[model samples]
Target: MELSRRGFMKAAGAGVAATSLGAMGFGGAEAAVIAHVRPMKLASTTETRNTCTYCSVACGIIMYSKGDVRKGERAELVHVEGDADHPTNLGTLCPKGAALKDFVRAETRLRQPMHRRPGSDRFEPISWDAALDRIARLMKDDRDANFLASNADGVPVNRWATTGMLAASATTNETAWATFKVAKTLGIVGFDNQARV
Candidate 1:
């Protein structure tokens, strides 16, 4: 056999190219490598069952948390996923439910009541008690000013036209019923539920 320089060069180039391509993952070897790399963060966490609060569907969720409260360290939420045993979700989650973990852990989430005074450009954090007091005072004033005792036909009627209550869809039926009763007692005629909207 005659060894030509051109043939030798071609063979060497092909060998180098094959080696480089294999190293750069031209084949499916990268997938195998990634498949073996499992996350260890959830290994020692505790799992709890919860319900999604975004809407009325009330999808079940499995919440994973770290540490144990009995051991002195507070448990922190680490992950959230649809609960397989839940009757509503059945191990599947909508886009919002799937991102519930991010929402719960988001840095921008409001932790306290905020109030922006008229003509103020920014919202100022307010205590929950102060916020509730202000809300009750304003609602009472509105109700007193707008309460109608009688119509033009001289019929006895009690209704407040200025105040409206929009109930959350995530509330349970009992809660909704209680809210409705409260609205009726307060003479609030303008009421709606978020689920209907």
Candidate 2:
């Protein structure tokens, strides 16, 4: 049924009154908000780019520097985000990639080699030099024991006693090159570098 002019005016006035009451908290607006709301803390920050080390995906990541931590300086890397402009991710990242910053700064990072004697309850830290020397010595001894100077037909072969090559990735260029040199000295035939792919 068509509302008379006076009736329409009355209805409009009622609607306005209800809205005002809700705005002023005279109605149950606050209760409605509380039922559907939760408190939130905000961060002030920005972004930057860094490579991904996790899988082979190598999606680009953006780091967000948040809340000021220093007396006069701005916050540093308070968060990490995905780089949308990166061709690989198109501005998206998997869970692992997204949390890259946290993983990098984790307190449990292994900063040094830890050695634990058999049956020992704890691990003792060791210097990198010592570790490298020990590994070199062990590898040398193994090669010496396995020296295979001949092929299947007994022809002279200069190859190492074993496969005669070492291969690995997950290292910087210089380090990988150094590793290649060491492997060559030991007559290693198989070689691989992470940078290959």
lDDT of 1 by residue, 103-128 (tens): 98889999899999999999999999
Error of 2 at 187 (Å): 3.8
Q: Which portions of model 2 show Cα errors greater than 4 Å?
A: 1-49, 62-77, 83-87, 156-185, 189-197
Q: How accurate is candidate 2 locally (lDDT)?
A: 0.73
Candidate 1 local lDDT, residue 72? 100
Q: State the weakest 10-residue window (summed lDDT) of model 1.
A: 167-176
In angstroms, the error of model 2 at 64 is: 5.9
Lowest-lDDT window of 10 residues in candidate 2?
Answer: 163-172
Candidates in order have lDDT scores of: 0.89, 0.73
Tell me, what's the RMSD of every candidate? Answer: 11.6, 10.4
lDDT, candidate 1, residue 100?
A: 88
Q: How many residue pairs clash in each candidate?
A: 0, 8
